[model samples]
Target chain A: MREIFKQEIEQLGLDLVSMAEHMSSAIDKATTALEKADLTLAEQVIDADESIDEIEQRIDEQAVSLLARQQPVATDLRVVVTALRLSATLERMGDLARHVADVARGRYPEVAAAQGRSYDILLDMARQASKVGTQVVELLRTNDLALAASIESDDEVLDRLHEQSFQVVLDEDEDLTRQQIVDVVLLGRYLERFGDHGVSVARRISFLVTGDLTNAVAMVAETSPRNSETS
Target chain B: MREIFKQEIEQLGLDLVSMAEHMSSAIDKATTALEKADLTLAEQVIDADESIDEIEQRIDEQAVSLLARQQPVATDLRVVVTALRLSATLERMGDLARHVADVARGRYPEVAAAQGRSYDILLDMARQASKVGTQVVELLRTNDLALAASIESDDEVLDRLHEQSFQVVLDEDEDLTRQQIVDVVLLGRYLERFGDHGVSVARRISFLVTGDLTNAVAMVAETSPRNSETS
Candidate 1:
């Protein structure tokens, strides 16, 4: 029974890793689809989000089954429950990626980035967000302490870039239309929040590794900078 | 052992009820503060949020203890885990309420509501959101099927009101300032999401009673309208 539980735990981790991989791909493609105004790519990203949701449902069911069958205690139980929570976060990340795609799809035939600096900054922001997502998968797969620690810093980078994109949009000259300005606002906020959720995933992993939920919340609150006043 | 577990579960329900009550109060005061520009009321809401967080922590520790000590399986296991998830959502509802207060505090001496119609709409949204929050508490306490079924419909009301607030802010006919527009956007989004979390709690209760996760997500999706386009 113990060996069976171990195998189930291993399989759950592998499934989460695969789901995170899909999330990373969605982030990468969504931004590219936004930047290039590639309708097909954006459509593909939007279409792919269903799979992430499906993956979450799978992860959740398996976690519940483990809970029912094994009645895992202490850390083992926390791991199963955390798997449930983590899958929800990952699924939200996928939706955020899809929101990015939706922005791209909503503005097809025209890019959301109105300024050159905005365009450049958004690409960089999305790259950083995408990188952290992939890093989350790595952290989950290997439980590498150093890798999990770095995810927070990566989120900070994405946050900074998000702020820069906003500065670019809000300060745009007359060439940028109001609707386009709205689009940039939407895109930048989406990217910045993507970073926040990345940090949330890392925080969950930290709790899983350390068994300290309270401290994880505090650590994140202290380390992460706020850039509010956006819609 | 069974009766002891049952007693612990009942206590968990009571703690959640108290926490949800706090959340509902926060929502009420927050909207009033925003409309009246009442700094003291807003501060009260903000300061009260920490207690809600504390309640969630206590609930989490107790739930974890139950999971570890009792090793509850099947329905009992689902209930304990669902309590964990439900508390987190309830805490987030508290944060959303705090966010509404933050908006009010930030724009004190000047109402966060820029337009008369927008102000009225926001107040109504807050009332509806607060109503559903308390309704959720009752559902948890009683497992009332009627109350559980009604939350989704209440959320629909919030969605529509949120749409109205958006229309009012976005179509500001030269009367509203940019910052006020941003505040309305933020406030409206916060209220809408509060409603979403309310539905999530109801869904979890439904799942606890029926053990159907997929249908809950689908019910929320089919019933709730989308108002995305914001941060």
Candidate 2:
């Protein structure tokens, strides 16, 4: 019975990693579409969201089923539950990507002609977010504590870029409406938040392996320049 | 052994519900401080957050210990894992409230004499968010599906209010700085998001009890109104 339950739990973990990968791909496509104002790609990301949503629902169901059937004790229980919570964050990350696509669709003509530098910055942030997502998947797949720790460390880089993007918007004297500037900053923020969620998943993986949340928290604290400075 | 695991898990649930209740109160106090620009109250909320964080960390550690030691299966596993996730959402909710407190502290002098109508709207939103949080706690305590379902329903109202708040900011020709308007709208958004997270906790509880993810997904789909309308 233990062996069977372990297999089932492992399968559920794989499903979650798959969902995370899809979310990362969706964000990548959405970011590219936003930068290029590719209405076609934007629409594709929007339409493809139903699949991501379905995967999320499947992962949730499977996690719950494991809970109902395996009745997994402490550590295994944490893994299943963390999978469920992580799925929600992954789904939201997909939704945020869809929102970015919608924004791109709305401002296609204008964004297509705008200076490429700003879009480039946004793209960089998206890439950073995708990297975090990938690291989360790898951590879950291998149960690699070291990789998870490193992913936690990389979150700070994403934060710095996010802040820099906002500074770019604030310092520019560009002929943009207030709404446009706000939208740009929010877009950066969404990507940054997506990375944060990815880091959260990595932390969960770390906790699952070590039964310790302190290490992940401490790593984040030490690596995060803002938190370090405050301390 | 089953009895011991069950007792510990039940205690964890009660602690989590208690924490969620305290979070609701914290948000209420923070929102009131924001509307009134009451710096002292804001300071209290900020300082009070340390306790919330400590509770959250304690709950997490306890859950992890329960998982590692008990190795509970099915329903037992679900209960413990659900407790951890609920604690996480509650912690983030408290953080959001503290963020509102920070904003209030920053803008107190400028917003002190602002019109009463704006405060009324914001306070109403905050109250609704608090109610949702309370309902989430009630659901956990009683395993009350009906109460959980109602909290799911309330999320729609919160979404509508979120939209209305944004519309008001956009439509008003008030002599407010863009930063001020954004701050107000973001506060409303944060409250709305808090309610949404409460609904999520309710969904997790429903799944834990029924092993059915359908109802939760259906509720989320219904509440997530089409953004195409804005376009």
Candidate 3:
């Protein structure tokens, strides 16, 4: 019974990794959809979010069953709880990707970037965000605290690009309409938030490694838009 | 032991209610700060978010301890898991309130609404959001699924107001700067998300009553921005 329980716990971690991989793919394709004005790709990302969400639900049920059946205590119990948190965070990251896709779909043939306005900065943001997604998968799979540092720096890149996106829109003297402005704002927010969730998962990974509750608590606080809101 | 565990579970529910009340007050104050351009009130809302975060952490710690100590199964286990999910949803709601306060603080001495453009819709959004907050408290306190109906309708109202905000910003040819446009967009989103979290809590309550996991799963998907993005 103990051996079976240990395997179930290990399986839970693998499922979280799979969920992260799905989110990484979603953001990659969603950003591509945004970059190229590809409605088909955007629709695909939108449809794929359901599968991501279903995986989250499945993980939740498995985690709950592990707790109920095994009655894991100490380190074992924390593993189950941590899985639950990771699943929720990954699910949210997938939703952020879908929001980006929603912007692409909403714009249809018109690129959300709008004739390459802020195009370079947005591309940079997307690259950094995609990097964070990849890092999240690697972090979950390896449980490496060092990789989390890289994710934090990636998030910083995203934050900088998020700020630059606003500057580009606000300072543009050429043909920037209110609708385009709204799109840029929403897109920057969606992408930046995607990075924030990456940072959050990194912090959760820290908690899992160190068993430091402060890491998780501070993580939740930092992910709040209050910290990221434009000053 | 059984009686003590029951009390602990009851206390978990109460803690969630308290957290909801804090979020309710924060949004109310944050919206008032936006309306009045009262920097003091905005700062207060920002600072109060810490206490809300602390409440969430304390609730989480207590919930985990209960799970470990009692190893609750069946209905008791569901109660604890539901409490964890509720605490998280409420924490996110508080952060949404903090984001609204952040906007108010970011534009100190100048109303984020700026010359009353889209001000009415924003005020309507705030009012509905605060109402949802109140309804969330009632729903949690009473375990009444009927109130969930009211929360869902309130979310619809927020959705409409969210749409109207963009229309107001887009149509207004008078004195709308890019910064103000960005503010309206972010503020609209924060307030709308606040309502979404409220509706999320409503669904969790339904899950607590019915034990139908689909309600909770469907609720999370519905709250994703895909369903709410401006068409």
What DockQ do the predictions score, one after another?
A: 0.36, 0.25, 0.67
Query: Which candidate's DockQ is highest?
Result: 3
Highest TM-score: which candidate?
A: 3
Best candidate (score: lDDT): 3
TM-score of each: 0.90, 0.82, 0.96
Q: Give the per-residue lDDT digits (tens) of candidate 2, residues B9-55.
A: 77887788778777877887887787678888888887787677777
DockQ, candidate 2, comes to 0.25
lDDT digits (tens) for residues A1-231 of candidate 1: 999999999889999999999999999899788778899998898788878878888888899899878989878988887888888778778877887888788777888654567677878877887887788888888887677778876676776776665556546363554455555555666677778778877778887887776756664343323235332
Per-model tally of clashing residue pairs: 0, 13, 0
lDDT of the structure predicted as candidate 3: 0.85
For candidate 1, the lDDT comes to 0.76
Q: Report the CA-based lDDT of candidate 2 relative to the real structure.
A: 0.69
lDDT score for residue B124 of model 3: 84
Query: Predicted candidate 1: what Cα RMSD to the true structure?
Result: 2.8
Better of 1 and 3 by DockQ: 3
lDDT (Cα, tens digit) per residue for candidate 3, span A1-231:
999998998889888999999999999998899889999999998899999988998899999998889898888888899899989999989998888888889888888767455777777787778888889999998889899877876677788778878878878585677788888788888788888888888887888789887777678678755556653
